[model samples]
Target: MSAPSHTTSYYAASANDKNLRPALQGQVEADICVIGAGYTGLSTALHLAESGFKVVVLEATRIGFGASGRNGGQIVHSYSRDIDFIEKHYGDKAGAEMGKMAFEGGKIIRRFVDQYNIQCDLKDGGIFAACNGKQMRELESKKALWETHGHNNLELLSDTDIQKYVGTTRYKGALLDKSGGHFHPLNLVLGEAAALESLGGVIYEDSPVTRVEEGAKAKVHTENGSVSANFVVVAGNAYLGGLIPKLQAKTMPCGTQVITTEPLSEAQQKALLPNGQCVEDCNYLLDYFRLSGDGRLIYGGGVTYGAREPDKIESLIVPKMLKTFPELKGVKIDYAWTGNFLLTLMRLPQFGRVSNNIYYAQGYSGHGVTCSHLAGKVLSDAIQGQAERYDVFAGLPQYPFPGGRTFRIPYTAMGAWYYTLRDKLGI
Candidate 1:
């Protein structure tokens, strides 16, 4: 089969820098070898390199070429999974710890952007809007749970307050998080990658890991070359493919489609999002949107569990955008694209070792932007012989998709249909 093509999104056209790093050739050795130059791998490489470890990152494509670069750029404060779900499955102590991790994950992202002087258009306002009373109640419950853990940055907003911020009457209420915001996701990833290189880390783009030999020392194979390292970290997430058979079975691919409109007038931009806040409605399959630095409306929200791209992604997403802001009736969509992300059955990130020297992290379940950053830090710590944080995620049980590889597409489609129905029925 041929390799998958990159998404044709506005991000690609307006990328911060377009320098392509050469792929791996011949052979090399390092203290740590990371696969996938997306957020997880790049962050792991960056942190490990800063710690004085010789690190090399292998990317199937260029850095941020996957969901890391193409996502809606919302810096949400929690995982895609519900906190109640975590509490019910794991005990209170474990649940609370996971909650803390989710909360701290957002902080970790902001801290890195600040410390590294990353110019990713960082902002600090986000809202989880409620479209109905039920969602409002859910948001309130979430607020209480967060408050229980001393997370006071969350503010519950009424319909009136919500309107003031979002300039839309469709939402009944909202949960505003002052600590959460949005940014240029691709820029952030690239900045981190550059930072990693500055710390003497090596990065090889277009170097897909074809196989892994796990033991005390692991060897990661590419098409033309390989890296033999003391520790190997698999941060490929959705793009991992068959590198590790077990890891692939635990998560299925889901495609997310997005589009950006031609730059709106300054006045028009403000009228849509008054405070320049990033907003998403409270729903299982959610719509997330934010105004770009130059005023284009970057809107995203549809999910396809299948690996193939939808024949008409723009038509599928544009109507949804119009539903929210009918004011942009005649606006032209400048770009449309889709990216595949991994959705694990448990909704929690999957982290564990194929062997003592081979560690892997994936299944952020759409929370990869921030969680991957945290995953990188945690994975780096584990590589350095500290396993407390790593163990927390690795302890989470992961069930393989029931239908195996052949039936994964159909199974995911059926499951997505159920959620789509719920979202439509407002259940």
Candidate 2:
């Protein structure tokens, strides 16, 4: 029952659910077929199942095998682009609806945990650390924007105040989202998978969908079998390879690295991140860290815009970790891993339908954990004849990277470098 296909992450090592499900062999039928087992697929299928619909999920490898299992684990709110982008580019009405859903994703996660009694070691508190005055000012504006949407569970911490939440003096200040938190991401997905099963939902591992034949009843084909269903949900995110040519062209997959250190003693934990909340610094390419349930410091940062895995993950991450926690110089790193996430030029999630019956949601950038859950609910609402919220997302314009496949990486990396420099010069 071991998940051999899953990445050798700290989460996989400490996974509570190792239940191996059978792969698709023969043709199966369902009300809806979800083509990924990550958060988006699980959330959509689970929501549909709860509404008394027959749901079947086909995972290419294993549950939480993608970014769903291996992320910063911070329950951050809002999209990567934030609400201002929506209001300016789209309109105020779209902005209002998008704003309402901004904080609901985290709430949905908590609701699933309490309603299903899923044991994922959920924790409280998350901080947006600012390394400079300009970043601190940006945090102030971000706080105001969230407040305008009626989300008020936030506190602005001065440099002195942040030192209590984080042991390091790297931050000039921070914005604390009391509703934002962290958890065992893999366990959360596994628990939700169990919750989906409780509603008679079915999931198949090692079931890479080859092609989805579009129709009133789309046929989701895998290597060995197929699923003919009333509707198809394409929720594979970055790992979804050439299945849909149109989708592959609109999004680019990018890699992010994460590492975990040997468990720290109680005193060690107290000295670093005394409040035990997840912390992500304010930078274009950011560094995020938090204390794991067993006291290990799970630190993650850096991005490979081209989706290529770094040759040495520890080399890219260790020095950064030490920069944040110099006291932990020479600390033993127990795990280092890299995973891919989908990104868009606009930095907003791409939600739409293919041929009217096949629905899809992807391109979460780095905010997949929270946004994917909201996507699931919105996608379900659309399928169940409630398309208002879904249209709010689908109506947004989607643009392909300007450089095409040949130079998109360099182009995106160049833009990121420009922003990173802005962060450095405090401009």
Candidate 3:
């Protein structure tokens, strides 16, 4: 088969990085070798490069080919599970450690953009719109909880106040996080990749790893070449496949579809989202929409429990868009696509070492954009002998789907069915 290129999303069409590096051929050596060139790999490599480590990146496909490039682009805070869940399950100390890191991802993103001069059209502000009274109360609780954790930039929005930010009535309330924001995700990753190269780091695209020969020195074998290094990082999220059988049963890939409307008039943009903040509604299977840098509205939702792509992307997402903004009834959809995010049974990301020196961080559920950046920093810290923060995530217990991989889809679908019913009934 031909080496994979990017999907036909808007980001791909507008991507600034078009240079394709040569695939690995002869064996090479580095201080650190990274597998997968999405946010996690690129971020980890960039951090190490800045610290004067000789880092090499191997990509199965193009950089950010996974959900990193094709996501909703919102820099949401926290994990898939909340701080309360972490505190309740892992104890207050763990929760406090996790809490302090909750908002670090967004900050890291801004620093990279500012320091590297990346042109990802970074914007500030994000919204968690509540669909009903119950969700509103949850938002109220969320604001209070997050405040206790030192995130005080939250403001609760009444039904009328929500209209000022988002021109919709579907939400009874909302929570505005000033520190949270959105941007062109693909460009951000590409910029970071370029930054890595600027610091003498190497990235080989189209070089998929076949296996890893473990021992005193870890050798990552690709189709045409291999890399011998002291350490290896597996940042391949959902598209990782079965290269490491041990991780096969630990995560499942779920597809979410996105659609972009043709450029709207300035008036229309104002009527839809006046402040131009990204909005994610409060629902079990929620909908998220944001204004693209080019003035088009990017909206997405609806999970395909399994990794299977749906037949009609526009049909699956457009109605949900209209439900939120009825005035956009006849708007033309410029682009429609789907991407997969790895989901863990516990909804927390799986972070740990594959072996003594092979590290990995995956399964961000629906919050890949922000958390993946955090993964890069924490993973790099471990390589630099600062494993305290990394240990916090690594120490979390990881479990496979109850019935294993084959049955995970059906099992998760049943649970989603329960919550979706609650969403519709507003219970």
Number of clashing pairs per prediction, in order? 0, 0, 0
Mark the regions of model 1 whose C-alpha exceeds 4 Å error after superposition. Answer: 1-6, 307-311
Cα-based RMSD of the predictions, in order? 1.8, 1.6, 1.1
The models' CA-based lDDT, in order, is 0.86, 0.92, 0.92
Model 3 lDDT on a 0 to 1 scale: 0.92
lDDT of 1 by residue, 330-423 (tens): 8988888888889988778899988988889999888888888889999999999888888888888989988788887888788778987887
Winner by TM-score between candidate 3 and candidate 2: 3
**Candidate 1: what lDDT?**
0.86
Which of 1 and 3 is the better model by lDDT? Answer: 3
- Clash pairs, candidate 2, are none
TM per model?
0.96, 0.98, 0.98
* Candidate with the larger TM-score of 1 and 3: 3
Provide the global lDDT of candidate 2 against the true structure. 0.92
